[model samples]
Target chain A: MEKIKVKNVFKIFGPNPQKIIPLIEKGKSKEEILKETGHGVGVNNANFAVEQGEIFVVMGLSGSGKSTLIRCLNRLIEPTAGEILIDGENIVGCDKDTLLQIRRKKMAMVFQNFALFPHYTVGENVAYGLEVQGEDLETRHKKAYEALELVGLKGYEESYPDQLSGGMQQRVGLARALATDPDILLMDEAFSALDPLIRKEMQDELLVLQARMQKTIIFITHDLDEALKLGDRIAIMKDGVIVQIGTPEEILTHPADDYVRDFVQDVNRVKVLTASAIMKKPDAVVSRKDGNKVAIRKMQEAGISSIFVTDKERHIRGIITIDDAMALLKKGEHSFESIINTEVPTTSPDTSIVDLLPIAVDTKYPIVVVDDDKKMLGIIVRVSVLSGILGEEE
Target chain B: MDKLQIGIYFEALIEWLTNNLEPVFEGLRTGILALIEGFEAFLLFIPSYVLIAILVVLAWKIAGKSIAIFTAVGLLLIDLMWLWPQTMQTLSLVLTSTVIALLMGIPLGIWMSQHDVVDNVTRPILDFMQTMPAFVYLIPAVIFFDLGEVPGAVATVIFAMPPVVRLTNLGIRQVPEDVIEAARSYGATRKQMLIRVQLPLAMSTILAGVNQTIMLALSMVVISAMIGAGGLGEEVLRGVTQMEIGKGFEGGIAVVILAMVLDRITQSLGNTGKTK
Candidate 1:
């Protein structure tokens, strides 16, 4: 089921919002409508549905209404018209009590400026959402502590927001949102305020958290690279309208318009694309139990000079070239251990292609992609990594 | 051209209020009189030296050592000038006015911050309260409370209340938009948002308003003494009418000392909240 679906959502700022919404519906441009009525159109007919456990990013430059659109999802900026459905329930026409309940029980948000309450300590800030929901003090504290640990801020609970660095403060912001255990997280340019290195760190941390939690998230960002990196599916907005919505690869490969094309054109794909996106299936592999003759037969059948060696569980041990297999056969060796090269280049599937480049340069063997258990998932050869950087599909 | 009968209309309005709201005025008079008496009695109950010691210690703790030393030396000079009782009275009056002003003004300020209509409606009224001569309200105050500390307090509260309201409203309004949005998105109820987020964040600014309110209240001491409200103001008034320059200077010096001590203490409080 779609976790949150926004349909025909319009947010007009200033007096007479209802009147201005009609003008928006009539296809009047934001600038023209603002000039005519002195009313700013914040979000014009924003329509999208975010699936459960998906990171649905809204990407646009400043004033493109991405922030406004995210705010409308939680009703921080009230939508002037149309329906917002959360888990198939229409939230647009819900009364104040119902809306408050929805916000309390269903959604929590993180902000761009790391809006950790300056007056509050990190733990207190994290506990704020639960406190507002009237949770008991003990539970609030426990949950807040757990959330701090989740965001890698276990010891900084008593520290004030301003005392921490900007990145640490944003971790507190993320922790606060996570403390609520809400079904959806609305991140409105949550990392845009951090320095570039910290921003990248935070993005990686968020992806790791999402992998574990599987919370539906609607992230907003102005940086195209950030969107491409974080978004499972990105909605590119322009002038309060969503110009395009697609996966990162799809957006990179086929931008819908000149605006989106311009955005993707400048993005450094080597840094944005990961190994997993371009990794090829292993043609042949010999288990630890396999004999030297079997390894040679498999490599010959696949027409490859080398093949990966794995245990019965598919945990990668090393690589064995045709010459090593031939040596093993000539020496009457039965075990593959003596000939297996344990110094094969390896990378996690999620490592960016840019990070893989140096390793890719020195290694003649394909880089082995593995999971946390060191179980081989796939292989990224030099050509695949190179083609991946060129925005080509293997 | 005939001049507008502003005075006549004002008199008639006061008369109408006095006639219709006599019981209400009487209750308020008793209430305000009790409040002032309570603070006055509390101040008087402590011996002069002990009270000074407490204040100096408070100054030391809150405002730092320099202000504390200044408070000790300055307060000793007031006692040396034999204005201890009168100084205490003025302090009590300032305290009473400040507390009352904050009580009424903060909620009104919060209301103004929440609603644009209330802000618009109260803004002009606040400006009038702030800018109009203090003497203008003193007459109605005296008529309503019948000439005593009550009337003085009423006038002082009216004169001093605007800054608290204005600053409270400004402080809450100035709370970063993103912070308020964060609170809302986290599902804080209106009251929770005010108490947990808005009020706590705006505290330093509101305390600044309180500082301004206290200063205004202290300024009204001499003016309030024109009525039967006795304080350092009475000494200054005596010095003025009887041509006792030394007494007036002594009274003025006491007031200045009191003002400095209070200012430093409150200013420090606001400053502490501002830092992380």
Candidate 2:
């Protein structure tokens, strides 16, 4: 079951929001509605489901109501219309007490501004959520320390928010959210305020945390790169409406609209496209079952000078060049090990094409793509690397 | 202009309240009288030397060495002038008025910060409270409680309460928007949000308002004396009416000394939670 499902939620901001819903339903543009009734559309007919343990990112520029949409999930800003179900409980129609309970027990949020209470010490700030839930001082402190240590800030317990650098303050914000041991996290542009290098470090740390925690997260951001890097799936929003929802590769390769296409166009595909994304099925690979004779014949048939050699289990053993195979045959060497070149470059399937460039450039053989156990997955040639950089058509 | 009769209607309103609300006025009068007496007794019970020493140490800790020395010297000068008792009385009155003002003002300010309608309704009233001549409050105060310290305190509270309310409201409202949103997102109930987030954050501003209230309360000391409230104001009034220039100047100096000490101490308190 989905952890959170938002179905046709609408958020209109102004006096008499309910009165303006009919106009939105009639398909009026945001500006037209504003001109007609002076109600600004915050989120227009948003619909999406977040699976448990998934990092579902909602991405848009400022004024796109991505913030509004995330707030709606927790009902920080009440939805003008529609149902939001969290673990099968509809948050939109929940009572105030239940909503508060849900927020206290089920979800926590991290803010873009690192909104640590200025007056609170780092320890106090981190423990604030637990404190709000009426936990005792001992449990709150213990949990707060644990959360701070998780974010690499265990020693900053007594420091004030103003005393810490921006990155450290942001960690305190993250720690505060994590102290409650919530099931879901709503991060609204949570890293947008940091310096670029620190932001990257924080992103990596979050990934590490997510690997351990496996908490479902709804991350909001305007930066496509951040969305692509962190999101399991991304929802692109424009003018308070979701334009498209897809994986990073799908968004890059098959954008649902011109806006999304234009958005993905400037992205550095080399950094985002992985080896598995562009690697091709090896046509002339030889296994131990196939002797040296068959290996040379397969290479010739495929019009290749070299072929990868694998064991019966399809784990990569080595590669053999056409010249080496012929030389071995002439020497009466029946052993495939004698003909195999063990100097073949290999990379994990998850390695980005950018990382593969140096290996692809230096190696004479196509770089072999392998899984964790050295199982041969495919081959990434120089042309495929170039094509991946250009955003693979296949 | 001849037919407005604003004065006549105001007179009728006061008369009606004075007659119909006798028990209410009596209750307020007794309550205020008890509070004033409690503070007065507390202040007077402390030996002049002991009080001065405590204030000096407080100043040193809060404001710095210079303010501490000034406190010691200035307070000693009040004692030297034989104005210690009068100074204590004025201090007690200012303390009582400030305590009462803050008691009502802080919650009102919190309430005002929460709702736009309350903010709007209270804004003009606060403006009127702040801008109306300090002497004007004395009339209602006198009518309600008769001539004594209670009326003087009532007038002083009215005169000094606005700054606390206004600044408290401003302080809470000035708390960062993202911070408030962060509190809300964490499932802070309305009360929790106010206590844990808003109040602590606004404390500095509210302390500043308290400082303003104390200053305004001290400013009203001599005016309150006109309605028979005793203290340094009585001495100043006596000196002035009897043409004793030196005595009046001495009383004025004592009031200034007391004001400076209170101001410096409270000002430092306001600067505590902030970097400043």
- The stretch of ten residues in a row with the least summed lDDT in candidate 2 chain A is A268-277
Q: Report the TM-score of candidate 2, chain B only.
A: 0.97
Q: Candidate 2 residues A134-196, lDDT tens each?
A: 999999989999999999998999998999999999999999999999999999999999865
lDDT of 1 by residue, A125-191 (tens): 9999999999999999999999999999999988988889999998999999999899899898999
User: In model 1, which residue pairs have backbone atoms overlapping below 3 Å?
Assistant: none
- Candidate 1's DockQ is 0.54
Can you give the lDDT of residue A318 in candidate 1?
Answer: 92
Best by DockQ: 1
| Candidate 1: stretches off by over 4 Å | A20-26, A267-394
Q: What is the DockQ of each candidate?
A: 0.54, 0.45
Tens digits of per-residue lDDT for model 1, B1-276: 999878898889999999999999999988888888999999999998999999999999998999999999999999888899999888888888999999999999999999999999999999999999999889889999998788899899999999999999999999998888888887788899998889988999999999999999999999999997899999999999999999898899899999999999999999998884
